[model samples]
Target chain A: MNSSSYYRNNIAAVYIDANALQLEPVQRAISKLTHVRPQTVTSVAEIPAAQRNLRTLYVTSFRGAALSACPGTRVHRCCNYHTVDLYAGCPLGCSYCIMQSYLERSAVTVYADPSPAITAIRAQALAAPEVPLRVGSGETGDSLLLDPLFEITRRYISELADLPNVHFEAKTKTDFVDHLLDLEPKGNAVIGFSVNARQFAVEEGASATLAQRLDAARRAARGGYRVAFHFDPMFRSGSSDGSPAAAAYRDVARRIAAAVDAGRIAWISLGTLRYTPALKAQIKRPYIHDEFVGCADGKFRYIQRERVALYRSVVAALQQYLCPQPPIYLCMESDTVWQRVFGWLPQQINELEALFAGAPLRGESV
Target chain B: MQMERVATLVQRVGPLDIFDQTRLPPDQLIRQGLTAVLALAPLHDSAAGATDAAEAQLLWGGPIVRRAAEIGVGELPARRLGPLGHRDALMLALRMEARAGGYSWSEREAIHRYAGEHRVALDTELSQLVTAAQTFAESMERYLALAPIWRRAVEAGAVDVRTAELCGALPPAVLDTVSGAGRRLSFSNRRLVLTWLSELCGRDGLHEPAAVELAQNVMQSADPLDALRRLRYPRLSAMEDRFAALQRRLTQGTPLELKAPPEFEGAGYEVQLTLRSRDDLARAIEALQRMQEESDELFELL
Candidate 1:
């Protein structure tokens, strides 16, 4: 770490990779800064074994369960545990990434030093004694993409697996599960993938093919790993005036059931397209755009009436397919959506706990 | 904050139909061609003659004079029909009449329509003014509804304790500001009338000494309206000073205090309660409606 170039801001340390300056445009920006100058350092392998002075940049975030308890839980994804932000930015830039709005620091840089992040995770787990440490590393960044280069996934599995109380969810979109095939699969180590219907997978999401994602999931399941699927950013596509939304939803369900077993699934999360003001602007393209997304009430994603109906249709389809259906939760949705689609409001944490313990829904906490 | 005053004020001024047109007063039906021709032309006798003769008569005599008469209806003979040449004055008088107490139903509808129109200068100050007017109504309503609860606590010989308890029921933003004052008694005594009035109805230019004196007369009370009237003039110089000091200490440069947005408070509260309370869904739903009403009041003000 070059002291002259690197300095700490209030919340985050500013690290300008001098190597990034090799690019002429990037270097020009660095030269424009008055105080700081980039310094060239060795590549990943050449980093010295013992460099005590080098202040490591660690991702410090609340655990999911702890986050769930926070007063502002609805806004935050309190996934019932701490999740790792494996990488900074996603390569697969979907039309509606919430990260675009929330994260001001937009770079595709992975924290090269995983030890500091791992240490932070361990410390967090140690701080909470009785609560099962549920930590994930895919919040700020995609969990996979740089898996082969950084080998962070293998490290996460090997290092965090020993802590029996800790659970790690490796969420990704790319079919990057080869690295995990040989590693001992801990039941706590949940492998997850985000999938939409084929149409969305093809048009909006220009990532791995639907077949490739399904193959990856099946392989993970075969390897005795618990799997989860995120039907996130559920694209609302049809004639502009809203016709045949139910068909689109039915297709989405059929694809999910065909791809993976319901029993092997840990949890399925359904999130409709929600956008913040900034993200909406960032994702707005000049031409070849869907105008419906822009017509929303201030800073809200305006999915059409048919789209909401389609969401309900998709939820219904999933309920019909996934036998002994895995717990379905709507992500970042209003209570109105919950009632209109799910027909019941979400159970409270205690009620959810009771449901978790196989208690009947007593209609008390509707 | 019930916005009862704004509603009352709007009613006194007239109907939504009156404000819908840019022309002030009910009868001054400014010719559409006149407005269009004025936008392009300058002030001159020749330009005035450019309009059709019959249209010119409607513009100058019957409608304009009638409007001038309407505005001068309650004024003394000296100020009556005074400065009829100034359209701005007419607009200001009309605005005052409509928004004196608070937004009337017609004024609410007119303002809403105005906001939707491109002509209205919907800048931040105006936005804040509109928002403050709405929140004032909402906060006062909440305070009034919960008054018995607060009064009970005070009569029990624990004024501070009861105030604290009542404060708990307030939205976080209000509670935070009230708490920072070391005692909400200041809010109850001095700031409440002004702040609440400012929120429910805009300052209404009562900040002017003459205007303040006029309003004091109209309100028929020197005790409460005096403080409320004082807010219109002077423009809260002391509160601004205190706010600056507090900003330096707490927020530094960054905005530490989120303006208690009256719209989302109820939605947020009900959403949380509905999720949390399973058995009393009906009670939660009812509370949600009250919150929605409060939110509706804010929109009405807007």
Candidate 2:
């Protein structure tokens, strides 16, 4: 099938590529977010046959910006909003890879084109020249994992160095800091990593181990790269009551303590494993099941009571490590989680703005 | 004074017990029901008009209503009496007589033409009207054959819940001035939930473990507001919040994912040279054009 089969959002038509037919049945399923039937055709020539009976929509990208409205994590992070999508899917098969289930197409697609994204960043920065443009590219896919393959980190440091106000955050799990050692480390850019404890990382995650991640963070910081850590998808596996939950929380707390220098951390994000019902089924699908994850609400894994305690314990543990206590942000979470974990829920914007401001700005406590 | 005359007219009419007629054969019922409805046309028209205009309209009416008037069908009753009472009465009578038994295709054609001639729209007023009517007729035929048995069952209190349900389609929800099911969600979602639950129970052969699992998943989602948040309809934010809250309640204990959904992929960039300086734009454009050309050449070789 032509490239369009991988992108169209709305329509009902089978996509078949001549080259694809001889291989494995493209194991990708249709995404409910976009109404489009997909079938991989054997021949590229038969692209017309696929299109003959149905509507095909053209799109440059399906997932939007990675970091859209910067919940200002660092005063130095882009003041304005920007996003970068470094890649589509990660090789590290985390069972809950949101993309694994959401993307209806099976193959991985990396945007080789970087100029348009850079131009867009430049335009957005210029639009709000005075305001810092908060932009990161690791949202759609792991930003740094593919960096070695494409020398992306090098490209970013060399090409995007001139735009002082345009802060670009490379959120990734791969260690490619050496590539950026020669380039002047701009205060605007921040390096982010999704991290978990060694045990959890070994059990549930497929990213770099805790030691590898800590080394990457230390090296990046030594090279003057502002670093941030995401305690996302925190595993809360014990029972709902006090001690089981406390143990899970303590383990997470201990991990965050040793991962990075407190002074160097730009911010720490606390996010629990939450998923939609559809993703829940995909989670239970025999091929993708993992025992480390437990259903909390229904489809959302991570036991509920355990999750709240975990969040509280992580934040508490981080307070001891951070000097000014690096500002904390919760990703895709409810106001209740914010209140239950951090004593208050910052305004839709303010709670996030604290991350970028270098301090938690006072917000109405709910 | 006028009410007594109307009652006398209804009593005199041959179609009064139309809803109760079960033994009439197919051809006979068709002939009788068709004739009765045709006969009542004039009375309905006259009754529908103002009291003063009733006589004039009846006198000048079309053939269908005129024939109805000749059969002693008087004015249709007042609207306060309800449409079901006046309009449905005659129709039910006709149904009891003419269509109580199955009709052949030709018989159906005759009925269709007759209904058209008298201005009756089938299958539209109530959903599945034609199918229901056919079922009702077949039931009537069966009842005629087993009237004594059915009567005995009724007398013995052996009529089941199924029979009571078949007495009529489910009654409309009671309208409460303050709050009710109607004010809560559209009937369609309610019906969807009901049908979904029914199918999950293996009623309509859709009793899949996955369906039940999905329902459970949606329910158990902690956010509780998750379902409404993802509604693709309406697009307005307010409606989304409302839908999310409702979905949360309906999907309690259901499994659902709470993550950023997946997205598709595309090429890296497109060049748009909109610099203020034409020279800058031209230079950038030239550079992009050259890069595109080179890439195309490289692609061709690959």
Cα displacement (Å) at residue A283, model 1: 2.7
Docking class of 2: incorrect
Model 2 residue B145 distance off true place after TM-score fit, in angstroms: 49
What candidate 2 gets wrong by more than 4 Å, as runs, is A1-82, A202-205, A238-259, A285-306, A347-366, B1-302
User: Candidate 1: which docking quality band?
Assistant: incorrect
Compose the digit string of candidate 2's lDDT tens values, residues B137-233: 3333333343343333333333422232221111111111101222343334433333223322332222345444444444445532334233211
lDDT (Cα) of model 2: 0.45
User: How high is each candidate's TM-score?
Assistant: 0.43, 0.42
